[model samples]
Target: MTAPYLIIFDVDGTLIDSQAHIVASMEAAFSGLDLPAPSRAQTLSIVGLSLPVAMLRLAPDHSAEMRADLVEGYKAAFQSLRLSADGAALSPLFEGAMSVLETLQADPRFVLAIATGKSRRGMEHILDQHGLRPYFASVQVADDHPSKPHPAMVKACLFECDVPAARAVVIGDTTYDVEMAKAAGAQAIGVSWGYHSVEDLRQSGADPILRRFGELPAALERIWSLT
Candidate 1:
């Protein structure tokens, strides 16, 4: 029998290393709002969550008014920084990311999509800027549905791709991604190159955390074998 279709990736740390921009923007946001900013390590831990979720984690004691203010401040600061960088805000894609996508896209049995916490507009901007837009068949973004740790985003991607949950795998750098995949009844594959440590990912219930991007195709082949 043919192997099952596989792979939905989280964009931020999984494909592209945007941690610097993210943390900088977040720090700027906190400064603008006069709120205490989370440290880089703290911010990294919440990377896969939605903006609101990240804010809540960073400022759990914030009032509703404060939350609104912080959100607005964050958007303004982030946009300003991104614009000031002249489109250079994005970090480079992980090593072999393009090659892995190309290899998988070339295979008829494999399918690829994006499941990310970034807003649809945000994700589109990054993908288009990097000339990576055409590679994904479907994109599941925060604006389109609920955020990570919730299966809605992954479920939407599964629906868009017309694939059963059992045939799909979610690959990401954070624990939130693993939990979301588990909630969706899909396999979870974690990449050690991203924000979270390998031990953290393992504790998050990711099966077989991969140390390098080059191992992805073979790792995925193994997941597909089960379905």
Candidate 2:
């Protein structure tokens, strides 16, 4: 029998194009708190971080209580948006995302999972909306683990899926994701369509950054072969 391999995806920038909804919700959160909203670049800079971590980075001078309030504000704003017709359309799967997911899930050699900075409720909502819940065997989120670059999420996925680091891979769009994969001793593949630059991903130790979703299979094969 062939050895099993695990492919872990990052939700925000990797599978879902959620930046618009995220940024809008963040702005609303700040507005609700009567605080200044960070610029798009500043907000996107901390895309893969946990809510509190992201908020703290964006407003370092803000007190811990302020950060907690911002977190709740952002969640409320995002939830409100999700109820709207326009916000209901938030996070469409990226081009070719469904294609790759379908193909991989149907293959016997691969076990799929998600490690994301999203709250479990939010992650479940998106997965259910996209009809993607059945595809992933494990779903790791900030509600249960630390933020990206901490390796906790990836380690949890590996443990749940019974996949060794050598046979596990993380595909994401940020430097945080790359660092997490490295810390977990798993191969990292960076997708270019997301927030971070290719140079940043490379600097974070991603090998052969994927320029498009269609390249994912080849990238995985190359990663496995080179190992």
Candidate 3:
């Protein structure tokens, strides 16, 4: 019998296309303080980091107090956007994402989990919004772990799912995800449809960089076959 392999995913850029909401909320947060907003590029670049860390990077010259305020502003703005009628459009699933997840979830050889930088509340909202709550075996969020590029989240998922690091794969759109999975002693697969470029993902040590969500099954097969 084949051993069960765990597939851990990153949410923001991997499964959900939330860039519009993210950029708008970031702009609103800065505007609330009369500060110059980060460019769309600037904001998207920090998508895989925790809110506090992201604010620190974007506003390095500001005092800690100011950064804290920006975090609150951003949270408020994001929550408001999430509750609005247009929320579905604000953060829809990427193309082929639903079908791919469904297929994976039905496979007995694999287990699915999520490790994301989203707050617990935000992660729950996304899960419920996309009917994804039941699909994941374990869900690690920023509320309980350090930001990405750290192995803490991935380690927790492995522990919960009872999967060895060698048999686990982290699929994400950012270099942060690649680094995190590597730090956790797991394989990393990059996705091209996210915030970071494919070259960046490759340089950061991700293998079998997938061009579409549908390509995941073969990527997983390639990674796990080596182990």
Candidates in order have lDDT scores of: 0.84, 0.91, 0.95
lDDT for model 2 = 0.91
Cα lDDT tens digits, model 3, 20-85, are 999999999999999999999999999999999999999999999999999999999999999999
Candidate 3: residue pairs that collide: none
Q: How many clashes does each candidate structure show, in the order listed? A: 0, 0, 0
The numbered model that scores best in TM-score is 3
Per-residue lDDT of model 1, residues 1-227, tens digit only: 64448589999889988888788878888887767788999988888888887888888898867776776777776667667755464567889999988998998887888999987767877787778887898888888778788999888878888889988999999999999999999999999999988888899999879988999889887766733
| Alpha-carbon shift of residue 215 in model 3 (angstroms) | 0.5
Candidate 1 minimal-lDDT segment of 10 residues: 81-90
lDDT per residue as tens, model 2, 1-227: 55589999999989999999999999999998899899999988899999999998998998999999999999998988887898657878999999999988887889999999999889988988899988999999999888889999999999999989989999999999999999999989999999999999999898879988999887777777843
Give the residue spans of candidate 2 off by over 4 A. Answer: none
Clashing pairs in 1: none
The count of backbone overlaps in candidate 3 is 0
Stretches off by above 4 angstroms in model 1 are 1-4
